[model samples]
Target chain A: MIVRPRLEDHLVIGKYTGKVIVGVGLLMVIPLLVSLGFGEWDTAVDFVISISACLIFGFGTQLFCRTEKDMNWSHGLVVASGAWVWATALGALPHYLSGHASSYLDTLFDVMSGYTTTGLYLLQDIDHIANGLNMWRHLLTYAGGQGIVVIALTFLFKGTSGAYKVYVGEGKDEKLLPNVVHTARAIWLVSLTWLVVGTAALTATGIWLGQMPIRAFFHAMWVFMGAWSTGGFAPQSYNTFWFHSLTYETICIVIMIAGSFNFALHWAMWTGNLKEIRRNVETISMFVTLSVTTLAATFWLAKANVYPDAMSLLRKVFYQIVSGHTTTGFSTVYAKAFVTQWGPIGLVVTTIAMAIGASACSTGGGIKGIRMGIMSKAFLQDIRRMVSPESALVSQKYHHIRDVWLDDGLVRGAMTITVAYVTIYAVATIVGVLYGFPLDQAAFEAVSAASNTGLSCGVTAPTIPALMKVTYIASMWLGRLEFMSVFALGGYLWSVVRGR
Target chain B: MMTRTRTLTVLVVSGAMLAALAAPAFALATYPPNKPDSTELINHQNVLGDVTKGLFWNGKAITFHGEAIGEVMVRGDYAWIHLNDDAYMVENIEEGAKLGGYNSGMAVWVPSALTKQIDTYGDYQHEGSIVSIAGVFNGACKQHGGDMDIHATSLRVLAAGHVVVDPVRPWKVVLAVVLASIAGLLFWFERKYRYLLRQSGRVGT
Candidate 1:
């Protein structure tokens, strides 16, 4: 029998939701200070305005819808979904007010992409943009990658029964520590440490590669932070292509691999479990996939006559393959030239890599290797079952920490999400093609944007039609939330609107 | 064991064949001077084909043939030209010296010697008129970093005409429409049959 969840239940959800919004408001102040420190008065003003708006709305919601207890699963889902949309709205204000983006829609798209770590952009001259604004872009990616809610839950919420629900809703599972706050802090610390190491190495490389020392330092810091976080924003207009040196590419590759690793593995490493490196399925899969795709792409580029020599071809191929697989979206080659020259095969291979995505519980986005591993195991089990008789109850198993048997419910849930992911990609691709893009290019952009992979076929330009931009924005939002929470939120909203 | 080995051999061979067939059209490093930095103009005056290959212009690295060769005026090291072979009027030439060239063509820098020859032989005309100039190939130009240009050795008159070409193709439009329609349908289907879509996974037995 169906039962209506009470208003009290919603109020319980609202109280945590209100706290999260307030936390988001507080977080905005850091970027605000960054903007002020950089003397970007306009950006600082915009941040102040946005923060004020967020605080007012958040506090108002808390006051009107007060509750005394923790939230339920349904409430948690609503709050999780609500936070993403609200955060995106607030995030757009700085872009809009600073005049970085021409329209509100473009601003929203940029913000959504930033927070989601999708790396897509509408701004034409990123090189000319101020340091504070650029930092804010990566900051969003770092925040969004770990999830703003996770930050809030860790710092603000104690004795909150909805923590696990919120965690799952934020598209993560498996905590590194017993306390949720400790787990959150550990993830942030590991990420920040990598960010520091990555930034320094990349900066030194940039200076050695002949960029002006000051520019090199800034580029190295921003690019490393973005790349390691899988944020994909480059401080310069040329993205990674501008540096045009092997050293720059190598540093980016290292950072991308680091970003694609699950934080839990990092935690295990920190705790002195050296064996965790070999045991982690996500890391192993990422390495294997990176190797195979890099070699394949290198071979393909050489065969296609795209480059004159094997070494040059390999360089281009490796850079792109790594970029797409990690969903970093920073291209060494011009997208227009790549699309025009390599044809459908190159596009297909890159898109497939993007769709396959990166390691779970990392900044990178897509279907994720963990899900892919789960799907692969399920497929093998089905094949085995078909060959065996009714008496044969062969145990279906896959290794995570250890050999773990999968039950029907778990497998079904994993499959459902995977299928939903593919469907989203397929739909987005069709929309892209319909708006005057080639079939291959359309599919590539759709999957790239939808998976928040950020790779482009030269179609994602400032001049792109508004409808197509809207399509990409929707795809980025849906991809980041992994579809389920968004769907759940929609169901909840519909129920409320219907007065059920 | 023998059968397994045979199967593996066949698979390997097949993979090799596929790789070979799908090989990139251009050979890496085969394109002579694989790095752009190593690109130098080899004197093969009568050579004709794709302009990119024939007579290389250092500043832009683009090669062109046909009627009027474009004129790009220069003073000191700086040169100004309307980008992408666009038409330039004398009044619209900004503050640079005038050189004779075709209307609606890329502007390029010429050596001082060639500029003097044009100044002596030709009458002062609007920058927009189409004209051809002969010149020795300069390896690279200083005005724009990382570009190539030619030093005009002489001037010549080719036919006066404008090059026109359509920008869009029918196939591109058709393909785009089809893809969009498919995307719309999928979105609707997913929305309508969300539960059904959810069940269709490779994982979850």
Candidate 2:
């Protein structure tokens, strides 16, 4: 006649949650150092306060609750889900203190957006924000792209059983190494290597294109972080258009494409298993979806006479498509141009690309290529079965680490998540529309938020309704965690509240 | 005779008042002529928007004033400049003292000689110069891959910008110190918790 939480439940959650909180605090240290180095006393103080708050809260949970239980699946899910909300709240500290955001809600929105790599910004006066605060914004996305849970796992999470559970909960399914720690290490290694290589490339480009050396280096790093993470932040509000260089755009395009690749494929290709690139299911899926959507948009733009020459068309139109498809949200064209210049057809195609999004186990978001691939294969298999004789044995197979069979459970799971993502996008769209935005523009921004793709047709701004802002924050959060974990969190909370 | 004298005095006063108004207009006319039609200013949004029969704005040689933001992007003999018409500038002129939000701005193409005259640009530490640009607006410029830009013939600094000083507030420092102290207390408790665990020889997830 009574409901109860096991002692171990409280302990395991607290322990790992504490470690994650510590990791969150640790992230602030970078910004703090930046502020100090730049002589931004106010910003430095913000980080100091932020770091202290995170540490106290994190360790407070650990002190109050202690346990020896290793994390079960449920605990991992809870920790992963709960930690995000906590990290986001704490992460908002520096931003809120910097006086850029109009409200705590606004700052929280920015942090959530950054952590989800959603690219929607609520922070006001972005161009005037301190270096440390700006670094924090880009840093959160860079870390978020790679999954902040992975940082906790790599550095703080000591026990393997619990560590692996939390890692999977953060939406990383692949065990890149035999050990969970090793897997986290490998992910960091890949990210850090890309950071170095990509930053160096962009920085050199920045310098050659005529910027001061220090400015060039930092801008390169920030831009590289955004591109490689498929995050849509820029140093200036003008975004990628600020540079106005073909060379810069070309390099960024390359980084976005490379960033959207499956990390396993990266590992395989790096380690001389070059054939893996052709065999990866996510890659094939991306190729088909990207090509189809891209062609459709390009055709519409050309017919409308949006661009005169093929070069300009390729540069402008093709750039938007890739950015959308990758869910990177870096656009060469103006935001309203999507509505006015490209018209209805272009908007539809772009929304499709945004919803489809980038590859799984990579620094991108949305109804990942793997799910789309599975759904497509499942559809084809059903058609083939319907056409063929009933007696004939029929099976579908796809290569993703190896030959993965299209089992009913696998198909159903993929379809369910895909459907959930679509529904969330739709609901957010409805919210946007109800708040007085045009349907197409509302839908565009909604898909952008829910899919973590940050292209806007003018709905996302400071003047947008509070309801709309909250809706977007939820969309980004739900989209990043991919629904199931969030659903799990909701269930867990409901049980805690109403069970007894 | 008295009525006629009174009428003459009234006419004289009215004529003087008219002359006084004309003097300001004459002074305004002395400044370099820019606007093709009327002496009206336009914001970036209006220049890029405000379409009429597919044309954004129906004029050439417009005069506009906006805060110069970021660096003057130099390329060959020409330079690309951005002028911000954000809430800050609006509120600064019309309402508040502080500027907030991402500004609405337009790209301006000017001669290299013109850009060098700017002493300050908008950023975290400094407010940018307010400058008046006499330019032709193009909604879709063919010269720069269909950019909505202004090709400027002349620029004049209307106002110089100064550096902004932002020091850490004492209250913020105090709050930080208090929070750090709480963290210290938590650290002590954590150490005790760890010691108790070590004594028990139990490893937690």
Candidate 3:
């Protein structure tokens, strides 16, 4: 029997959701200060309005839904999914207020795209946008890269079992420490350390490339946020190509790959388990897949004589493949170059790299390396079972942090999510084709959105159909959260609608 | 009087013939950019597309026009300037320009002497100088680590960029103040409830 959610359930969910909104509101302060610092009075006013709106919504919910009850698993999942929806709607205020977006829906699309770490944007004239608004854009991706729930847990929420549930609900299940709050802090520690080092390196590179000192610092910081978060929101429309520096590109590649590693892996490396990088299954899977895709793209482009020299071929192909595989969405070449320059084969290669994405429990969104690792082991196990005698027992094990035996449930979980991803990719592709996009371009864009890899092959634009925008938005949300929590949210809503 | 009249007619007719003959040459020199017919001029899309189909434009003379944006990075004798040809190149978002997709532009490597003609570069405040470049397009420049760029032989400023004044909407400020006041009251109310809950041991510190 489908029992409707009781009053207490709603209260707990609402209270936690309110807290996340408050955290989001607090986030607006950083951009507000930035706007003021730049003397952008109009943009600062946008942040002021947005901040006030968030506070009102947050406090209103908290005051109305005062609950002593703790959150259950369902409440946690609902809070996670519901919070993102609310965040997307409200966080879009600065974007809409900027008068750059075509409509509120377009602003929502950009906000969702940022939160999901998918680099597709509909905000027009990014080149001419105010510095303060630009700060908010990059900051959205950075905060969203570290699960928003993690932020609430780090600062707002107490160290309770409910915190862990909410943490898992945010699509990050790995616990770097025994306490969930401590785990969240550890993630921040890793990110902040990278932020310092990556920014300095990029700033130096930017300055060397002839950018002004202040401009270099800002660009460096924004690019670092985008790179380390594996979020592809560059300040300019040209993206990484704006610099036209090999040194800068190299630095981005390093940060992007490092960012895509599992948080637990970072914890291990920090704790002097350097050998774990070699032994980890996710790392191994990433290496093999990245190599295959890179080689395929390089060889194909070389054959087509796309680039003039070997140096040109390697720089463009390797940078793009790494960007795609990391799900970073940062690109050196123009978006259409994938279609017009590299052709169908290049598109297929990049799509494959994007589909098989970065490590599990990382900021990146895709099928994930760990799942691929497990599935490959399962395949091997099945092959061994076929060769063995009727009485023989076949089993397989893969090393993540440690060696763990692959069981039916584990395989089923991986397969289910993989199937879900493939299904969404197909649906998105069909919608795009129906809108008159070519099959290959549609497939490429659909996969890009579904994988939360923001690489565009000249498909994503402000002029795309509104329905396609909605479709991509849903794909990004679904892709970011994986499927289970969102599915739970759907089931919860359905029960509310038709429950006895 | 007859002789003077005849001389005047001959000069007028000759001048008219000469002017007519020079018009086509002048028009060819100032051809419109981005309207390539597989012959003379090419845009960003064409440059990229032609290269992909094994049509290399390396060291080929091409004419391009766009609004000069960002800073001019002067590296010794040569300077790098990015020029955008997007819809907003003429007008901007603050000026009520309609959305026309993402910015599409190319990097031009021009002499430091030529870059002095640009008065403004596009950004939030200004609409940048619109310039035309007659250059040799390089598919991959060996000097700049495989960067696709144009080496400009000559440059001309077609239009001057100007400051765009963006006024703050009064209604937004009024709404912000009202919302902030309400939020403050809610915060106080929520804090009061939290204190009560804490006192009753229903919530933790």
* First chain TM-score, candidate 3: 0.99
**lDDT to native, each model:** 0.64, 0.81, 0.87
RMSD of 3: 7.7
C-alpha lDDT of residue B161 in model 1: 30
lDDT of 1 by residue, B1-205 (tens): 9999999999999999987654322221122221222112322111112335333333333333212222333444433221122112221122121221222222244444433323211111122222344443433223222122344434443223322221223543454355445434543543445445447852210
What's the count of clashing pairs in each model shown? 36, 0, 0
Model 2 pairs in collision: none
Tens-digit lDDT string for candidate 2 (A1-500): 33545677877788788889999999899989988888889899999999999999889988877776678887888899899999999999998888777788988889998998878887777767788988999999999988999999888876567788888888788887779888888888988998999999888888777676887888899998888888888888778887778889999999998888878878778678889888889999999988998789878777766554667766787788889989888877667667766777888899999999998888888999999989999999999999999998789999987899999999999988899999999999999888888888899999999989888876798778888889999999898888767777787777777766
Better of 2 and 3 by lDDT: 3
Off by over 4 Å in 3: B1-33, B36-58, B140-142, B199-205
DockQ of each candidate relative to the true complex: 0.02, 0.27, 0.32
Q: Give residue A264's lDDT in candidate 1 (0 to 100).
A: 76
Q: Report, to 2 decimal places, the DockQ of model 1.
A: 0.02
Kindly list the per-residue Cα lDDT of model 3 for residues A1-500, writing each as its tens digit.
Answer: 99999888888888899999999999999999998898788888899999998999999898988877888888888899889999999999999999998889999989998998888898888889988999999999999999999899999998767988888888899988999999999999999999999999999888888889998999999999888888888998888888888889999999999989999999999999999999999999999999999999998888877677899889999999999999989998777778766788899999999988888889898999999998999999999999999899888898888889999999999999999999999999999999999999999999999888899998998888999999999999999998778888998898888877
Per-residue lDDT for A360 in model 2?
A: 84
Write down the lDDT that model 3 would get. Answer: 0.87
Docking class of 3: acceptable
Please give the fraction of native interface contacts (Cα pairs under 8 Å between A and B) kept by each candidate.
0.00, 0.46, 0.51
